[model samples]
Target: MKITALETLRTDEFANVLWVRVHTDAGVIGLGETFYGAGAVEAHIHDTLAMRLLGRNPLHIEAIHREMLNLPMAQSSTGVEHRAASAIDIALWDVFGKICGQPVHQMLGGLCRDKQRIYNTCAGYRYVRSNNIKPVSNWNLEGNEGPYEDLVGFMTRADGVAESLLESGISAMKIWPFDPAAQENQGLYISAEQMKKAIEPFEKIRKAVGDRMEIMVEFHSLWNLPAAMQIARALEPYKPTWYEDPIRMNSPQALAEYAASTNVWVCASETLGTRYAYKEYLDRGAAHVVMADLCWTGGLTEGRKIAAMAETYHRPFAPHDCIGPVGFIAAIHASFSQPNTLIQESVRAFYTGWYNELVTTMPVIKDGYVYPMEGPGLGVELLPAVFERTDLTVRRSSL
Candidate 1:
């Protein structure tokens, strides 16, 4: 069956996350969600890539992915073009799974294990609520409740936060206490005082939980090589899961140098666009673990390829999911299908909070592990009430 229409829907209530609906000549319609820049990604979907998808077989996911990126302006980058293609590819995969009467993870390759382990990225309810991604210093969101509170608490109360996640049966947690310094210093340098302040949480977590919990430090790609190297070397004693995106991902040579400077493994960026970008990081030995955001890295079609490529290099693959609900579920599908996958990222703030407000299916995370998602396609859809919100915006293109 061919695509009859492509439509984008958004609500200011959710702000930055946009949903796409791919209508087929058959009765089924597939759903996809993408995070960041809803307005720009929406325009790219309709004005730039919709024509290429309008009459195509919805099951030709790879070909359609290429067609969407074949335009000279769209090629070889992970910008708006790839983001638009990613959402469409996810929708098409939903269609493919529906056609085969299977869940997306089953369609990918069937589950390799009963469940996958996960790590929580400490973030507040209001984190990434807008298109602008500058790090936030304040944790004072209006809805900071007792059971579900701790946006920036990872820094101030590392011990309490660790205890809380352990209570949920989650054993791994990720935090980025050094980012506010990078933002202030332009990633150029971290003074001794700043370095001491940043290491406080690491010290606290190590003191509180000992080796019972796995801690991952996120640099948010907000440091220069010198500062990143200094931070990386300083944290080697704590033994973080990996120093993630410590510096920018623009150059593999610099990252390789930083990786060589310390024993700590480097987990590279999820902001990269395509497999070629990941290849550069891999071939250069810049990163020990390769990460991809399925939503931004050309969806599951491309995420699967990246996973295989990481396998070829003997590197563990991890899918990034600090985005919307549908993308979070899509990442879990990719995580289960790939044999080399190490773990997946999730935020209790997102999963236990806003994620429920937008979608029907919530991933099963308990005892520090996430079970393979059940049901056909992505196993989730926009809540029907989402469409009725007064702040919604929609645009459509048809064959």
Candidate 2:
């Protein structure tokens, strides 16, 4: 069947709004979630990409993806363009799966494992319980800021939050304490002492949790090579699971150099999109763990392809998840289909409420493992009325 229409639903969840939607035809429809900043990707999809998607063969996922890539979106056919393409690509795979009467994972090479390993990203409750660190209201995934005197109290709340996550069967956790003081102003430069203080909680979390759980330090591309290297060395003794996004996403040469210099295995590529972009990272051996977000890397269609490519190189992949249920389930389908998956990321905040509101019949996570849903396609059906109730605006981009 030919493509009929593409739709997007943008909702205000977490600090910023995220985009999710489905592509429909007369017979079958596919679901996808776009990975982008607040108002960025939804506008791109609704405005320009949606028009191009109409009347094309929705099953021609690879061809459609390549057509979108030829457009000069963001810069050099990368950023926002890939995000829009990813949404469409994912939906196409969903349609493909439904047409064949199988889950997307089954279509992607079948299941390599019965369940996927997951780590809790919601450490607010856990951190507070175990370390006496109280997190601020709505920890925006961008870290926090307060008076120097408030550091002790914050640590206390954080300890408890960390403990809670571990108690909740989270064997590993991720924290985006880019820097305690630099939260409000991400571009603000800080002294070396301040940086040390920022990572101190992680060191404390390690001491508290010991080997009970793995801790991942998220830098959010906040440091230059020198600063990132310095911080990497400082945290080496603690033996973190990985140092994520130590530097920016540009220049594979620079990324490889920095990764080679540190004992910490550099984890990058949440921003990088598609198997095309992933090739550079793999060719350079820039990362030990390639963090590919199926939502951003062209959904299950391309996500499974990228993961398979990394597997050939003997590198493990960790699918990034910070968006809604669509992205989360899409990542699971892609991860379960690949044998090289390391661990998947999950935001407890998003999954708790927002994800529940979007779909029905999803996988259940128990004891840090996600059991695959035994339904067709992505295995979750979107509630159209819920989509309407959420009150998301589908704005068109000028492009």
Candidate 3:
């Protein structure tokens, strides 16, 4: 079916999310989403990508993905160009799955397993709610919100949070208590006091759950190599499951050095765009576990390729999902399709909270494992209410 129109939607309430809809001549519409820099991504979709996408075959996912990334600025980075292309690529895949009457994982070459394991990414209901994605400001710790105000829970009562997660059958949780300190010192150095304070959550979790709960530490790429190495050394005693983006992902050699120094697996980046960048890390033995945010890293098309490359290195793939519902669903499809996928990332807060308000369906996440989506395409759709919301902004480009 020929692509007829490209539509983008954003709401003031969810400032960092942009939803894309690909309409085809055959009357099937595919939904996709990308998170962060919503404005720029939206502009790119309508202003730039539409020219390459409109009137083309919606099922030509690879061709369109290449054409969209033809711009020099779109290469090897999760910037606006890639984010916009990613959304469209996901939408194109959705169209393909719908046309084939199969789920996206099947379209990607069928499932490798029945269910994929998951870990809770400890973020609050309103974390990163606004466009201000800086460390402290983006925390959005103003109110209690609900039971899973997990960002606060991890900071103040990590031991309790661990127990709560275990009660829900979630054995692993990701936390980033070091971000505030990193922002304060500009990632140059961390004082002994800062170091001790940052280790408190790990200490508490160990005290409460012992080895029952796996702890994943997220550094948000906010530390220098020396400081990151120091932090990794300090946490080696705690035996964290992995250290994510401990330092900037730009330097493969530097990241390799950091990985060599720590016994903890270094999960290198959701920030990277494609397999080319991941090849650098995998080639150097820098990343033990590979993580990619499907929405930002070129959707299912590039995401699956990255997963395969990681498999070649004997590294496990873990899809990131601290973003929107559609991206989360897409990640699940990628997770189940890849044979070497280790686990899927879930934000209990998002899936249980505002995510319900936006989407009509979500994957069955039970007992820390995400079951495969059964419906055709991504197996989810934007709720009718999202379109009817007062804060909604819709833009369209057509053939």
Candidate 4:
């Protein structure tokens, strides 16, 4: 079926997530999502990518994907142009799955596992919704069930947080207690006292849950090489499942050095754009677990390739999903289909909070593992209520 229309729908309520709908002449519409920078992504899709997509066969996903990236700007950077293409690529894949009457994961390869293990990235209901990422004080505009409920626990009551997650059958949880300190020190260095304070959460988790829980330390790519090495060595005793984005993502050499120095597995960056960027890291053994945010690092198309690269290097893959629901579903498809996928990153806040508000369905989480989403084409949709929002912006370009 020929592609007929491309539409971008966005709502500012949840960190400005942008949704794309690819419509075909056969009356099938596929949904896709990308988080952050809704305005810029919308412009790139409608004003630039629209002409290349309309009237083409929606089933020719790779050709259309390459056609969009053919723009000189898209090849050079993973900025707005590639982000727009990533959303469209996901939509096209969704359309392909619908046309074939199968789920996206089945199309990706077939299920490698019945259920994928998941790790909760412990974030507050409003963590990613704000602009200032650190200080934790910026999140004070909202209050959770208690101080231990949200971002506060990572700083004060990490043991309680660990206990809470374990009660829910989630054995692994990720926290970023070090990020605030990294922000304060400009990622250049941290005082001995600050380093000790950052270790408190892992210490508490170890004390409270013992070896029953797996904690992943998320550095958020906020530290320099020297600082990251020091922090990694300090946390070695806690035996976290992994250390996430300890240093910046752009340089493979620095990340390799950091990874080599630590016994902890360095779960490399989601901030990297595509498979090419990841190939460099995998080639250099820069990470032990390869992390890909389908929303940020191209969609399932590139995420699958990254997973393959990780497999070639004998590294496990974990799909990052701290953003919105659709991208989370997309990640689920890739995670279940890839044999190398070790785990998937999820957010308790988003999955239980705003994610339910906008989407028609969510993944089935049982005893800390997620089963493949059923139905077809990512197996989820934006609820009509999202369109009814007064703050929503809708734009469409037709063939």
Q: Pick the candidate with the highest TM-score.
A: 3
Candidate 4, residue 11: CA error in Å? 1.5
Clashing pairs in 4: none
Ordered from best to worst TM-score, the candidate numbers read: 3, 1, 4, 2
Model 2 off-target regions past 4 Å? 12-25, 37-40, 74-78, 123-158, 181-192, 394-399
Worst ten in a row by lDDT for model 4:
132-141
Which of candidates 2 and 3 is the stronger one according to TM-score? 3
Q: Estimate the TM-score for candidate 3.
A: 0.99
Clashing pairs in 3: none
Superposed model 3: Cα runs more than 4 Å off: none
For residues 1-399, write the lDDT of model 4, one tens digit per residue: 899999999876664589999999999999989877778999989998888889999999888877987777775345787778878988988998998899999999999999899988877777767544344554543667433344776678888988888888889988888877887888999998998888888888899889999988888788999999998899898998888898878899999999899888889877888888888888888888888888777777878988998898888989888777899999999999999999888887778787888999989998899989888888899999998999889999999
Model 3 worst lDDT run, 10 consecutive residues: 44-53
Worst-scoring 10-residue span by lDDT in model 2: 125-134
Off by over 4 Å in 4: 131-141, 145-148
Clashes of 1: 1
The global Cα lDDT (0 to 1) of model 4 is 0.85
* C-alpha RMSD values across all candidates: 1.3, 5.8, 0.8, 1.7
Ranking by lDDT: 3, 1, 4, 2
Tell how far residue 154 is off in model 4, in angstroms: 2.3
> Candidate 1's residue-wise lDDT over 1-399, tens digit each?
789999999888677788899999997889987888889999999988887789999998878888987888875566888888889889989988888889999999999899899999888777777656667543335666445555668867988999888888888888988987888888899999999999999899889998888988888888989888888888899988898998878999999999999898789779887888999989999989999998888989999999999999999999998889999999999999999999999988889988888888798888999998788888888888787888989899999
